[model samples]
Target: MGAAIDPQVLAARVRNALPAKFASEKRMFGGITFMVNGNMLCCVSKRGLMACVGAAAEPEALARPFASPCFGSGRRMAGFVTVAPPGVADADGLNYWLALARTYVEATPRNASGQKRWRRKSAATEPSRAAA
Candidate 1:
């Protein structure tokens, strides 16, 4: 399926708020993700915006209206929160979340080598997409 508008707009707004040197965009999980210092800073998925504010801030971030603990696939991601579409309807609201994520991202260390730190599982570990 094609990408949805609300998430797309949310992603764009956050991307704009990030410092050029701190943010790099990558498309993943059928949405846009912003990486900072080789770590995932934030992303906008079909459900809405997902922010990684570090483990310490997750509780406060989840208190916002329309905010919820975030998950990837079926498992919960401890440091992330999902800001619902209603929560980020306006630019100001969008930036508010962006600022939260930026704070944690800014404090994180960067890998100057610039090599990708994550590795995908081998195709052999899973079922094939091709029909039998």
Candidate 2:
């Protein structure tokens, strides 16, 4: 196994690599997720650096060293890849993944609301509703 990753260090690197405009951070997937134009671009979590490289590029991305498909609820999350710490231990490697994610995010069509279309909310995070 590779050296353990420092979450704070990896988060800082992701922040530094992101463009100043059109980028925002949110807590999701048990980590810090970077969004571009209201769409998920990448995230830093225990699993490593997860990038939304788009479904078309998924095959190629997975072929790269230390890259693997991201899974959720026992199913593959198409278009997302988790790169191990060793893959993003350096600036160049991180930049490569970030760039790929950025390109895909930028190409995605924006919703009329100009906000994230959907996200699964945990019970704790979801707002409660009561019959009036």
> By TM-score, who's the top model here?
2
Error of 2 at 4 (Å): 3.2
Q: Could you tally the backbone clashes for each prediction?
A: 0, 0
Tens digits of lDDT, candidate 2, 1-132: 445687778998988777577678888888898887678888897667889999999999999999988987899999999899999999999999998998898999764334555888998886777633
lDDT of the candidates, in the order given? 0.79, 0.86
The stretch of ten residues in a row with the least summed lDDT in candidate 1 is 1-10
Writing each residue's lDDT as its tens digit, candidate 1 over 25-55 gives 8887667988877777778877778888889
User: What TM-score number comes out for model 2?
Assistant: 0.81
Error of model 1, residue 55, in angstroms:
0.9
Candidate 2 structure lDDT: 0.86
